[model samples]
Target chain A: MKKLINNPSDVVNEQLLGLAAAHPELHLSLAPRYVCRKDIPQGKVAVVSGGGSGHDPLHCGYVGFGMLDGACPGEIFTSPTPDQMYECAKHVDRGAGVLFIVKNYTGDVLNFETSAELCKMDGIQVQCILIDDDVAVKGGGHTSGRRGVGLTVLAEKIVGAAAQAGYSLGACADLCRRINQNGRSMGVALSSCIIPEAGETTFLLDNDEIELGIGIHGEQGVERRCMASVDILVELMVEHIFSDPEYVRVAREMNSASGEWEDVQLVSTPFSRGESFIVLVNGMGGTPPGELYGVYRKFAELCDEKGVSIKRNLVGTYISSLEMQGCSITMLRADDEMVRLWDARAVTPGLCFPSCDDVTSCGTSNAD
Target chain B: MLTKKNVLIWFEKSADAMAEHKQELHLLDAAIGDGDHGINMNRGFGKLALELPVMGAMTLQEIFKHAGMVLLSTVGGASGPLYGTLFLKGAATVGTSEALDASAVLTFFDAGVEGLVARGRTEENDKTMYDVWAPVLREYELCLEAEMEFVEILAACVCAAEVGMKATIPMLARKGRASYLGERSIGHQDPGATSSYYLINALYESIRE
Candidate 1:
C-alpha cells in the first residue's frame, strides 16, 4: 500500500485541500463539506451532484461555469450526509430552485432522499434525478437496480447546460431524466483498488482474468472473464451495452408541487444499429490517456463496423474508480437536444469544453 | 428500566467493540461486499464515544436521538443510514422518558427493525441487518410474554442475536452490494449483521453491569 498521504483519516480532506488550492475558483467548505462555484450567476437553476470521494473530478470537479453549481462529496466510497447536501443547496440556490443529480447506490439514494426532505421542509424547491444506467444489471426486484456509472458525467453536463440556458427547475429535472433514460455504461476492472483506511486490495484476481459489470467502487463486479485483447474487451463491453433489454425500474423523485416523494417508473430503451451516440471511453483511475485512446480506437472501429454514427465523443479518465486498472465505456443514444447540450460551453476544473469567447485574440490581426 | 447512564455506557462500550472487531468485519465484507463496514462502524462509534459527554443532560430518548444523529452524519456506507434510522426511530418510540422499561426496550428494538426494513427495502433472508434484528425482536417478545425478568429477557435476546448473525452464512444475498455476487456471496458471514450483533450484545452487557 505505497502511496502519498499524511494519515488515512485525513485522506479525503487533505486531497480536497489540494483541489481547492489547484482550482481557487471553486469554493471549498470543510465543515459539512461541499464545493461550489464562487461566482454563480443570479437566477440560474442550481444543479448539485455528489457521491463517494474516490471518484474525483466527478461531482466536485464538474462544478464551474456551465456545469454543476455545487457538489458534496462523502468519504472515500461512502455517501455524503444530508447536512452537506442541504447546505450546498442553500448555498447555491438563487431563487430559481435546486436539482440534485443522484446516483442509484442504496446509501446515496437514502442520504440524498433525506436531504431532499430537509430542503423541502425549509421551503426550497428541490427535485431529484436518479441515474441508473449500468446495463450490466438485469433486474430490480429485491436488489438495488443498475448502478449509476459513467452516464452521471453526461447528466451533469447536459443538465447543467439546460439550467444555464434558463431552464426552470422542473424542466432541468425532466431533461436530466430524459438523458438518463437514453444512456448505458459498462466497466471492466483488471485489478482491485484500495481504500485509504482499509490499506488492502478490495478483491484478489488472477493475472489473466478481468472483472465485468463493475461499479466505480472497489467492490467485485458481477462476472469474471479470462483476459482478452483490447479489441475483444471493447467488443464484449459494447455487446453488453447494446444488447441489454429495456430497463424498467421505480425511482423516487421529489415533487415540488405537492412537497411529496413520488415513485416514478423509468424505462431505458436498449441500444440498436443505425442509432447515433455520444460516446465516452473513461479510464478507471489507473489507465492513461494513450491507452484510453487505444480503447476509443477500437470502439470507433466497432461503431464503423456496425453502421452506427459517432456524433460526439470524449475519451479521458473522467469518471474513475480509485486507482483500479481498467476502463468503462458510456454511450448515450443522442437526440438533437442532447447533442446541442453536449456542445454547450463548459469550464470546470475537471472538464473543459470552452468556446474561446474572446475573438479579438484570434484571426492574426495583431498588426492593427 | 434502562437508565440514561447505562445508555451512555452502551455507546462507549460499543465504540471499543467496533474497534476490536474492526479487522474481522473488514475481512468478512472483503469477501462479499466492499471492505469498509468495519471502518465505517468504527468511525461512527468513535465519534459517539467523544459525543457521549455532551449528552449527559439529555434523557434516554435524547441520548438515542443524539446517537442516531452522530451515526447518520459520520458513517458513510449503507450501514450508516440503516443504523442511524434504527436509533432515531427507536428514540421516537421510547418517548421523552428518562428511563425505559423492559417492554419499552422491546418496543424500541421493534421500532428500529421496522425502520431498517423500510429504509433498506429489505426482508428476511436478504442477508441484511434485518436477519439478526428480526430474530432478536422475536426472542425478546417471547421472553417478555413468558414473564421473564428484564435481565433474563435481554440475555435471551442477545443469544438470539448471535444465532441470527451466524444464520447469514448460507444466505444468497438479495440486497446491497453483496447481491452483485449472485452465488458467490454465499459462505461468508454478513458484516452488517455481525456489527449489529456486537451493538445489541453491548447494550445487554451495559445493562447487566
Candidate 2:
C-alpha cells in the first residue's frame, strides 16, 4: 500500500512505457501491449509469447535477435485480452508463420485460442506450443495441466534461436516442442505478492511457511507446510521431475519431433556430446540472484549425479512473482544442434549470453 | 408489492449487506481459497446497482440478462463467469415473460441453478455454489407446489438459501481453490455459496416489497 507508483491503474502501462524507452531495439505497441523486435525478419519464422504482467523482462526482455519475436503483456496476474494478442500476431508476422508460446493456465489458454482464431481470419498460419513443465498438480482434476514456470522462458530462448537461425516455420515449431518436452521446472514461494490495487498481500503465510510448486502468480501450490532446508525442498522438486515416467516419454517425443531421427546428431561421439543443456535457476520476485545461484548449485549437483551433461548454466531472476521470495529451477536438455543454437551469442536488456562452450556427452563430472 | 422499483431496492439492500460483511467473507476464504470473495461479490453487485435503473422497463428476464452482462464484464474472476451464466440462463428460460408468478419464479430459479451446475460442472455435495443452490431450489419448488402466496414463497426460499449457505461449513470442498486444501477446507464456509445466498435474499426481498 505504501509503495512507489503514480496510480494503481496505470502501473502496467507506465512500466511498459519505461521498457520501451530503455530497450530501443524492441518495438512497443501500447494498444496491444506487444514488444517485438525492431526489425522483424522477412519470410522467417516468428515466435510469439505472452502472459500476465509483473513477471517483467520475461516475454518482453526475451524479445531480441535470438529469442521471442513478440510478447503480449497483459494486466497484472490476469490474461491479456484476445485483441491484444491478435494485434501482436499482426505486427510480428514474417510470412513464413508465427508460433504462439502459451503458458498452461485456463485464462491464458482461452484468450490465446481466441487470438489464434483472429489470426486465422487473416490467412496467417500459426501453431501453439503449450508449456506445462511443472511436475506437481498433475493429478488434480481441477487443473487442465501443470503450471508453466521457468521452462517457458527457456523454451522461448531455445526456440527463438532456432527461428532466428533460418529454420522453417515447421522446423522452428518442432524445436519448440522439443524444448518444452525435455524441460521441467518446480518452484517454492516463501511469501505472497501484494497487488497494487488490492493494497494487501494476495495470500498470507506464516514466517515459517513455504508452498512447494507455487506458480509465479501466487496460485496455490501442491503442498503448503512449514519451511524446510533448501536441500529437502530441492529433493522433493527434483524427485517428482526425474522419477516421472511421463517425463521420459515426453523427451522421446521431442527428440523425434525435432527431426533428430533424420539427422545423424542423435548419437554420442567424441567430437561433441550427444546432448547438452543450460540449467535455469529462476527467482520469483523479492529473491536475490545470490540465493538463486545457491539453488543453482543443487541443480548442478543433481545433473552430475544423474550423468546428464550440462553445457551451460543460467542463474538469475529471469522470471519473478512481484516481490514474492522464492526460486524455480528449470533443466533444458538439449541435443547437439540445440546446444549450438543456445551457445549462439545474443544481447537483450533482460537476458544475455556472452560466452559458450561444448563438452562431452553424459558425465563430464570426473573432468572439472 | 414486488414492483420493479422493489427489485431495485433489493439490489441496493444486498449491496449494503455485501459491503458490511466483505471482510468476514475474505477471512473465511483466507484459509482455504484466495481472499477476494467479499470484495469481488461486492464489486459485482455494485455494478449491477449502477446499471439497474437503465434497464428501461424491460421484463424481469430482460432486466436479469442486462444484470448478467454487467457482472460478467466487471467481476474479472471465476465467480463472475459462473454467477453471470447462472442469471443469463435463468433469463433465457423466462424469455420476455411480463411478470413472475409463484411457479414461474420457481422454474426460473431452477434454471439458474442448473446453469450454475453446467458452468462449474459440480454436483450437490461438491461444497460449491450448488451446495446452496440445490437446497434453495428444492425448497422453492415445494413452496410453489403448496400454493403459497408470493410473499410466503419468497420467505421460504430465503430461509432455504441460508440453511444451504451454512451447511457448507462441515463439508469437504470438491472444486476450485478450496478443494486444494483437502481436509483443511472443511472448517471455512464456502464463499461462493455465501454470495449465492445473498443473491437469493435479494430476490426474496424484492418480491416481499
| DockQ values of all predictions | 0.53, 0.09
Off by over 4 Å in 1: A1-4, A139-142, A204-208, A354-368
Model 1, residue B97: displacement in angstroms?
A: 2.0
Task: State the C-alpha RMSD over the true interface residues for candidate 2, after superposing those residues.
Answer: 4.1
- TM-score (2 decimals) of chain A in model 2: 0.86
Please provide, for model 2 over A1-368, each residue's C-alpha lDDT reduced to its tens digit, 9 standing for 90 to 100: 66678899899889888888987777888865788887877988888999878897787878877788889887677666566777888888889878889886645654565566457768777777678777665554443446678989878877888888888877886787767777777788999888887778887899999988887888777789999887788877777666654532111111223322121111111112244667788888888878877777777787777667888778888888888899887777777777788876666668765432212222125444
lDDT of 1 by residue, B1-209 (tens): 68999899999889999999999988998788877788889999999999988999887888898899889888877888789889988999987688888999888888888887877878899998889999999899899999998888888989998999999999989988888777888899999999999998898899889
Best by lDDT: 1
- Per-residue lDDT, model 1, residue A365, is 37
In model 2, state the lDDT of residue B120. Answer: 61
Cα lDDT of model 1 by residue, A234-276, tens digit: 9999889878888888888877778877789998887778999
Clash pairs for candidate 1: none
